[model samples]
Target: MRAADRPADLRRDLVVSGEIHYFRLDPAEWADRLDTAVRTGVTAVATYVPWLVHELPDGTFDFGQRHPHLDLVRFLDLCAERGLSVIARPGPFVMAELKNEGLGYSVLRRNPEIRAAGWDGERRPETIVDYLHPAFLAAVDTWFDAVIPLLAAHAVDRGGPIVGIQLDNEIGMLPWVTNRPDLSDRTVAEFVEGLVATTSREAVQARYGVGATSFDVTDPATWGPALRSPVDEQVLALHRDLGRFTRDRYARYVQHLRAGVRARGVGEDVALLVNIHGCWGERATMFPLGISQLHRTWADGDTIPGTDIYIGDLDLDTLPGLWTSTAFLAATCRADQPYGVLEFEVGSGDYGEALDVTTGPEAAGLKLQLAIAQGGSLVNYYLLAGGRNPELFEPVGDGNDRIAFTGERHGFAAPIRPEGDLATWFAETVHLTEAVTDAAELLRAARPERPPVTIGFVVDHYMTEYRYPGSTREAEFVAELERFRGSGPREIMTRALVVGGYAPDATLLDGPDALADLPTDRVLALAPTPSLDDDLQRALADWVRRGGRLLLSGPVPQHDMEGRPATALIDALGLDVGPTHAATPGRTPFVAPSITPDGPAWQGAEVAVGFAQPLTTRRADAGTAPLAHLARTGEPCVLDIGLGAGRVVVAAADLPCLPQIWDALLARLGAHPRIRITSDSRGVVVVPCRTPDDVEVVHVINVSPWDTAVALERDGRPVTDEPIALARRSGTWLVRRSGETRARVAYRPPRG
Candidate 1:
């Protein structure tokens, strides 16, 4: 590919890169590290140019004049000479465990007014600055003026190696993680302006019950001791409005940086990337929160959004979360927008040096396979090689003397140790990268096969970020939302479907045309809370009337998000919503399918209800049939109602992770898995992808801890007569050529 066409061209191919911090590594070891990255079959290298490291105490910049390790230009040239492309990340807030989050200390220390303040009107404990504050943006502009020119000169368009530029590292991460929204005066002003622009000034005043002007619209004090006794609709509305404003502010900050860099010689041909942060410690229950927070930044298709995946090892428990996270990322993107992993975790999970957490050697390879299987085209292994942390230009005398807070030697658990020795996982990394390179063409051409079901992704459901510090009402509200959004639907429902051999896609309901392109042949499953938006309720009713099959779990929505009456879906199904009952200590609630001798065989099977809260509803018309009933009372917990040309199955009870139950439920909606695993083990997952030319490949992953033989079939026809022996935590891709099956080992655990 031509240098000018590198960014766009790289997207077409499976671009596997590794992050190597040149500033952290010794100048003498640059060549060796570059060669080591090349040996791993990586096509490019990514590094963060920390503004804290290069900026001098006098506000001037130093590019290797003061320290040899700070020579970014020399490192870029070396990477280019070694035939490796580059991805430059110059961050005004690169949170690589650095003080002030990679910003110069003088910047924050001298201008404390730019610091972000929380709902308490106090500065946040973290050094998170107001992203769009005038002072902070001015400093960012100065930093960009100094760094973008250097990066632009080395960019692919200038016959250099830089292929992409990451705008800011993990935008809106600190605020979310710290639960501290920027409630500074400037931010509040901007929020009021946004509210007025979107709605009217009168609307803002009426909503907040404030003075006649937008200036009187003050930030709601949701936190601290001043919180209201019973949190009312006004507080919830303000919180939601603030969340929306924050997302818009983050997007504007990115756009401002993008414009600044473009003006400073960075061409439009260079791919601009954003690192989305949400998942942490391998748990992906709240991963969609990051997408919701930063959706405005990348939803326009102008910029590419990459998820920072820190999911350690792939197991049956973690597989569903990873798959859902990856699938959701893909679903949120435009058809032409390519998404990838920005910080693909590698090595041990000992960031704090106290957890004693160790990632298995085979973890990286398995994650790579799963990511690719779920439509990831690019992979950047974070800390592919380790290095020593350089001394800060001006030390603050805060304990350890290093630029980063991680200590003297950084990335000690990486595949390449800080001392330049290969770690235990190096060989596995090499194998996985080589395998991807071998099948680059096929993988690039293939796309995930369309599944028979599409799960509804409700962005507002995850707007549970703001909370009163110790308010019981706030705690209960958050728990309730988490149950419906995180635990019940995301964790249980998603896992049950995937493990049951069903590949389901996701559709973001926040979009204006959410159901416009929804396939009528597929079942649309949603986990609704007690309340849903009025517009969405109507849209879903119309969709069902237009012949779209619907499956709903949890309670029937009787009100909108603000707790106002809105029951279009319930009314359409001819059902009366009833009270929800929780399982008590002694009298445990259970649900069982109603026995029908002539019904499907699965209807006779009993559902194992383990701690599931069941909601009771009554049929108001003859069109509704009781599929399941609460064992405690005989009230219908699961109902199948027929609409004009479609059907709606209301599963009022939160189902557990039972494959048989999910299979039976989906079967009722005329949905079946294309790929089936007829194995006793439920740990194996099958994902099928097909190229444009009709070439088919199936990815069989065994996420269990023990070896198992899996029998796979496609459309009820067996692919192979003999069972395929898969080692523990291993996966393989089988390609069908004519009448023969060829196996490409993606990752296999080393045998004893």
Candidate 2:
């Protein structure tokens, strides 16, 4: 069905959902808990229908006959009666601290072949199944066959409350580590089949030479490469291809599940939801195989792919990852679809290993604000209330004590307490819900403006798993690529951009289309690895041909994605790449340093690290113009060349490491933000979103510990003459429409 013909629920904005596990709570208290959901201004209630809970020990289905609380249809009807929408999660694998990760105990006992095998050919620590194993898929199909029809009956299109259906929960968390690849036979067969279908054996032999005949693609340890002083070309190719194949399998798994959901006859407005885990660096780096490609894997027009964001003590330092991941997810999602935070933290849960998240309305409000500012539309609070686990095991020692799965009173400091009383966060929840409702019409139609500077990125470069691991020349090159494109240019520079009061846009350099649609007036910063995708090289050449200003860092592309020499963009620019010179700390400097704190990239900056000077260069032709020179070499380190109507700025030094250099470069280009924001303090992120009707709202968030006087201006003219003093670690939204511009002063902060 066409999107326009879908139900009004699809177009209606402001979805404030709270998760309430109906099966975990008593049937008598379900009405009261649901009442709390509506009273706290929740438009919807989300619940996970565990397969283990519903399926009896005899492999027969039991929705509510045995226990009244197990009646999912009845629970959903109750939510509808209370005017609340429902997000039903019928997970064949729901990891809610349950035995077997919510899969029925008999499931694994009956079908041990479904269990995912680790890299060492051992079963995974958790009862996680290999996603594509025949046995597993069969089991899941049986489960879905039983559950989908029931969910379809309760769907909103049929006058039921179910608006969304979640396929699986954290799909790849069980074996996400590097050495934890699912090495099961079925998984290996699929991987081999995919490789044979997509890759050419002749090319593989040519690249690997004579000894490639003995290498087995089906073997896990012998799958990719054997570490050596100098890795063979065949090994490298095999490794890279393996990474691609793995990513493809993950994508196919989601695709298959989504098809399963769609085949169940779900309505157009009743969307399928897939949640991607880990919004920050630690998880992204550790599980690069899954987290890196999950966004790209679950890319579908009808499905909503959302991230799971948990703000605990470990993740406080990398809050910007939330913004980066959100931006990437939004970019990766279907155009016009609202990106959501599927599992947003409501509060800390005291079950299993305790996670202590600060419990206060201010922190909760701040997280919600940040998500919205970073372009999150649909947000589901992880839990709205706590509940007791059902009796699954018999008593062993004490008469009153039974072997409960996650302990009886699984308390999560949420809006509703275990006894059904309102928590302190109730008011905060209501406030955010009301605020989103008031601005829903405008926000639903609004899109973030392109930043003055856009960071062009290649996904493969950041996918560390694709890199051939060894001490070989190829390995060293990959290491250099990691360093060149890793920290300074990507993370630190983005932080600099944000702190400078500009909402930087991260543009994925996948193909020519992303480049063609790039803001023509803005500066495109392209800091990529030495190995570039051939298609991207062609796109870059095309982009240069059509008058697009670019900032090129690191070495010129010497190889393609397949490790073949390709210099399409380099040849077009007509540049002579020269020798490298490592800059000494506190010694190496710009030839003539002239820096002023003018632009947002340079506002109140005090950088301690030495700037990264990558290499020195000299122009190959007279078409280039020298901009700046390296002090150590006096060679042309920074130069600009005119291509067609556009100009390209090539820098030898890493622009991110040197904020002053970045500032000077921007100054030279005469590039400035369209809207200017000035603050009395630092660490405030100012994001401006404009609706289709040109209704603009600026969201100012203080990420620091101190308060600040903030002022906003468009084209150097103040929207309001007076500067407002914003509270520390708070967000103040300023909206202006039809000549009426003002701050939301009546909006209360969290009281002491």
Best by lDDT: 1
The lDDT of each candidate is: 0.77, 0.64
Q: Considering summed lDDT, which 10 consecutive residues are worst modelled in model 1?
A: 222-231
TM-score of each: 0.93, 0.85
TM-score, prediction 1? 0.93
- Residues 276-353, candidate 2, lDDT per residue (tens digit)? 765333323222223456755556666777677765422224544555666666666666666687787676433334
Please count the clashing residue pairs in each candidate, in the order shown: 0, 1
* Tens digits of per-residue lDDT for model 1, 57-126: 8999988877888899999999888778898889988888777789987788777898877765667668
Clashing residue pairs in candidate 2, if any?
547-646
